[model samples]
Target: MTEYARGLSHEPPLKPERPQFSSGPTVKFPGWSLDKLKTESLGRSHRSAVGKARLKYAIDLTKELLGIPDDYLVGIMPASDTGALEAAMWTMLDPARPATVAAWESFGNVWIQDAVKQLKLPNLQTLSADYGEIPDLSTIPQRNDVVFTWNGTTSGAMIPDTDWLEPGREGITINDATSAIFAMEMDWAKLDATTFSWQKVMGSEAQHGMLILSPKAVERIESYDPPWPLPKLFRMKKGDKLNRGIFEGATINTPSLLATEDYIAALEWAKSIGGRKALFERANTNADLVKNWIEAKPWLRNMVSDPAKRTNTGVCMVFQGDWYESLSDEDKAAVPKKIVKLLEERNVGYDFNGYRDAPPSLRIWCGGTVEAEDIERLLPWIEWAYETVKNG
Candidate 1:
């Protein structure tokens, strides 16, 4: 049992003001609402001047907040993070060259499937580790094309740094940074193609993917054409030249203007909170709260053993202690389900179950949009639910 939960009070802990904590589509900024979104671009043709300006507003703000280099290009893509990542894999990876893939969790494995199964790159090297651990990045050759995730959305493991990448690497690095962009520090100097969705760190609506391409990645797309067919959405180049229009807000497919407005509003909120520094502080504070809570309890622990590799967002937690360890396999698996049911029943939290492919866990989201007070309020309720479930 936890230290603070030692008392035998039957009353429930106080509820959080906002208990919505899904990893994706997370809780909105502290004061977000429908009325705050700009409606000028709604129902208007995206090609029109005002519509393009509206889209560019979100793009420019993203670049500003991210501190992207001047030479790099940032564009909005058709699908969510999946689409943006797929686009990068298709356009940049030359099947002729050998490729290296590193996977520590669900989303990273998806990129592996894309490389070996879908893209069918003949000479491929795959590096993988268990759910809570990271693979050795140093094993990969410096010049081989590499694909990886900046943060494991499902596994709670994250790469500490990109020192494994050489400064003069010949091969491109494609990164799925959906959960890490705003909350964590990125080494843009070594990253080639980076993709994210607004729904992740900013707590905005989904459906559109944001892509940033380094000059090297752009050159590869412009110079080389892969042997396989390119989907219309994945074709980022027109003839031999880069499709600069897409980078300039001429989307290949029609975009949801309402979603764009929501993204803009969220970016405004982020800027109001003092940009990247504040965002990192919010995620760090919430993650530390969870870490301290876990440390104080005998029955809980972080899935990731190494502190440097643990993620600030999408933190995966495993149950410990004699009772949990003594349970049969089936009964152990049922523990998280019962606890989740109790939490949902009380409206304390929702959608925090670990990914289906992973070991049973309570995957709490400690991203920038999640407030510290709400996390503090929610933790005790989780303790209460666990105690109630275990006692029964």
Candidate 2:
């Protein structure tokens, strides 16, 4: 039995008004209404003029929100973030040059697998770190194309800054920023290729990938031909020239016009709240609320020990009681599942379980869409659930 179980306590008085906090398809913007997308060009061919205009509007809004460089090309691709990343990898990676992959979590590991095993690159250097830590950026060779995830969503670890990247490197840097883009600041000047999905930070629909490429990355596509055969979805170049139309609203395949409108609505919401700075502040404030709660509760500790590396979007935590530590791995896993189930049953929170591949812990979505007051309300329920599970 745990100390919390024995202590005299009453259940928390309030419940969060909204309880949709899955990391992907996160809680929609506060006051989001489906009616807002009524203007969407529904049932229209994506190749039609109106459809093309809507797609272009989404691209322009993304550029405006992120402040992407004028030289960079932004495109909408198939298969969400994975598709954008795979397209970049297949189209830009030079078979002659060595490839370097840095993986600190599941998504990063996927890229590593693509480069090392799938592509079977001749020269490959893999830099890996544990769940809570980032791989050492200094070990990556400047001459080798490097691939890494800016934020490890599953692990709740994020790269603190772009200082680790060499400013004058000969090779390109491919970053998967699906969970990091709008919630955090990125040094765009240092990144050659960046990819994200609408479902992550913006709480929009899935299956659409946003691919951003620097001039250098575009040049790589035009200059170097990959040794592997390119799929239609992965091909970014037509003959020796880069496909310029793709960057200007021409998609490799059909896109969801409704999803495009939702993204536009999300971007408009972002603008209404003062854009990137406001979004970051919301996520940071929610995270700080949880951080303070974690400090007050001795039984809970952050999954990522380093405060600097902690993710503001996905706040992962573990139970720290001696009782919890004494449990077998299977029991430890079962405890979190019970706690999550209890929270859900009580309507206090939802999808608070850690990533399946990660350590048994609670992974809370603290992104812009989640309210700080709600996080404040939800903490007590979590304590109650944990105590109940521990004692039973």
Q: Which numbered prediction scores highest in lDDT against the true structure? A: 1
Off by over 4 Å in 1: 1-9
Which residue runs of candidate 2 sit more than 4 Å off their true CA positions?
A: 1-9
Q: 94 in model 1: Cα distance from truth in Å?
A: 1.0
lDDT of 1 by residue, 1-392 (tens): 55534433643557778888889987889899999998988889999999999888888999999999999999999989999999999988887888899999999999999998998888899999999999999999987999999999988888998889989798999999999999998899899999999899899899899999999999999999888898899888888988988888899899999999999988899999999889999999999998888888789889999999999998999999998999998898888888778778878888888888889898889998898898888888778778877887
Inter-residue clash pairs, candidate 2:
none
- lDDT of each prediction vs. the true structure? 0.89, 0.88
Against the true structure, candidate 1 has what lDDT?
Answer: 0.89
Reference-based TM-score of each model = 0.97, 0.97
Q: After superposition, how far is residue 82 of candidate 1 from its true place, in Å?
A: 0.5
Error of 1 at 256 (Å): 0.5
Tens digits of per-residue lDDT, candidate 2, 4-97, equal 3443365677889998778997888888898888564899888899989989989998999998988988999999999999999988887789
Shift in Å, residue 199, candidate 2: 0.3
